[model samples]
Target: MKCKILPPKGLYHPVLPYKQLTSDNTHKLLFGLCRTCMNKISFKCKHIDDPTLNKHDKIHEIKRCKECKNIKNEKCIHSDEERVIVGTWSTIEIDKAIEKGYELQKIYELEHFEKTSTDIFKLYVDTFMKYKQEASGCKCDPKYCKNDCKNDKECKTKIQYIIDNTAYDLDIDKVKYNSGLRFIAKICLNNLWGHFGMRDNFTQKNIVLLLEHITKIVFNEKYKDISTMILDENIVLTEYKEKEEYSKPNPSVNVYIALFTTAHARLKLYELLDILQERVLYMDTDSCIYNDDGSEACKK
Candidate 1:
C-alpha cells in the first residue's frame, strides 16, 4: 500500500518550491528540486550518498554505491521504501521464475526437437555437431600436393588472370604473406555488441550463455590433462588502442582481452594488459614471445 507521506519527522521545512515533498509513513525525508536546477547542480550538490540507503543491503547482493548509477537511483531504492516491492524472486514469486528457467530452453526445443518420436535429438546433435574439431582451412599444402589438375589449360589461365589483375589493376595484397590481426578482435566484438547490446535480438540470458560458450572453448579445450602442453606454449592476448594521450571512449575491450588471457594462459600476463572494458575493444592473439622492445623474436 502507498503510505500517505507527510513531512519528514524531526526535520525542518524545505525553503522554496521543490517537487511535491512526500514523506513515507516513517516520514523519511524525500527530496527533489526543479529539473533545470537538478540538471545543473546534480554533478556537484546532489546528495548522492544517501546515508540510510547507503547502509541498507541490496537485493542482487551487488556491492556498489547506489549513486554510482545516475539514472537508476530511484528505481533501485525499492528496498528503502516503507514496503519493499518483491518480485518473482521474493517469497511470493521465486518458485515460478525457477520453474520457468528450467522449463527447457525455448530456442533449443524449437530448433532441435524431432517430431517423429518424442525423443529429443539435442544430446546427439550437440555431441556430434559441436564436438570440437580441428580448425582447418586451405593453407597452401606445401609438402605433398602435386595436383595434375594444376597443369590443365583452364586452371592455368585462371591463375594467370588472378595474377595479372593483381599486378596491373589492384595493388597486390599486403596482408597475404602474414596474418592480419584484427587490431582488436575481442574488443571489436564487445563494442559492436555494446552499441545497443547486439544487433541480433539477444536477451541478457542469451548473452550469459554466449559468454559461457566462448569461455569454455577458449579455456577448457577437449585435450584432457594436456596442461603441460599449454604450459610449454606461449600465449598472448592483445588489445589495440590507437592513441597514447587521449583514447577512445570504449577502453573496456582491452580489459576483456586481458581478463581472457589471465584465464587461459599458464603464465601470469596480468601486468601486460591494461584498460577497462567500458573504454577499449579487443583485437587478436599472437603465439610468440618477443624482447621487451620487440626487436628480438622468441619463436613459439
Candidate 2:
C-alpha cells in the first residue's frame, strides 16, 4: 500500500514475533483518527471455545491475551486467531507493522485522503523566510553560520545554510545572546498551523449576575455541554461547548491541511526511528534521543 495521502484506519491480526510493530499508545478500540476524515469503524470478531477447533479454526479466538488493548509492546492475542482494532496508521507504519508480524483484515473509509499539486502555504513560507533573511544582516551571523562573510550575498548564503540544517532558524539561538525571536517565530508558526485545525465547539465562559441569565444558559439547546460555578451570591461562571450547528467555524480551518501536516511529521519521526531502532532512548513529536556509537548514526 503506497499511500501518497493521509494514513488509513484498519483491523489487523497479529502475526508471530510482534516486537517490531508500532504498538498503539492509546490501547483503545478507536485510537488515533484523522478528524478530517472521521474514519471511525467497527468490527465483529468471533471467539469460540470448542476443543475440536484447530488453531486456524479458532477463528477470531484470542486466549489469555497477555496484552489487552493499551498495553505497550506486550503480545496481545496468543495466536493469529484474533483481530484487534489497532488504531489508524500511515501506510509506512502499516508496512513496518506487517514486517513485525501483523496481517491487515479490514478497513473502513469514510472519505478519501486529499492531495493536490498546488502548495497551500507557499506564499506564507516564502514570505517568512525572505523576511527573516532581510531582517538579519550579515553582521548578525548566527551560530549555524559556519563562514564569516561581509556581503549581502554571503548573508543569503547564511540563510540557505540555516534552511538546509535541522536547526529551524538563527532566532532559535538568538534567545540567549540576542532577543526573544525564538518565541516570536514559534508562536507565529504555531498559530498558523493551529488556525487550520481549530474546533468550532470550544468551551465558552460567561459571567452570570442575574437569575434569568442562568436560566437562559441552562435551558439553551445550543450549549450541549454545560457547567456552572458560583463565585458569589449574585455571580456565576458558566462554561459550555456549543453544539456543532450553533458554533462558528474558523474560516481558515481546513482539516485536510492539518491532517497532512501531522501525517508527514509522524512519517519523518518514523523514518528516524527506523534508522535508530534499538539505539533510540526517548522520543517526542519532533525530537529524539538515541545512543550514538561515534559512527554518526544519524547520518545513516
Residues 1-300 of candidate 2: C-alpha lDDT, one tens digit per residue: 322222223323221111122234332222221322112222122334578878875654543333322233333333222323334444545665566445566665434547664467767765554445433434344463333342346555554565466323444332122124434644666677898878766788999999999999999988888999999898999998888887887788988677667767766776777677678788777899988876666668
Pairs of colliding residues, candidate 2: 27-70
lDDT of 2: 0.54
lDDT of 2 at 55: 80
Residue 169 in model 1: shift from native, Å?
50
Q: Could you estimate the TM-score for every candidate?
A: 0.14, 0.57
lDDT of 1: 0.28
lDDT of 1 by residue, 1-300 (tens): 111111222112111112322222221122222222222223322433445454344322233434545443433222213321211111111222223231111221111224334225345423322211101111234531224323555534543454464322221221122222222433443344254322321212111234455354445433222111122234323222222233334433443333323333312221122212112233233332323432222111
Q: lDDT scores for all predictions?
A: 0.28, 0.54
Instruction: List ranges where model 1 is wrong by over 4 Å.
Output: 1-71, 74-76, 79-119, 130-132, 135-300
Error (Å) of candidate 2 at residue 94 is: 5.3
The lowest-lDDT stretch of 10 consecutive residues in candidate 2 is 13-22
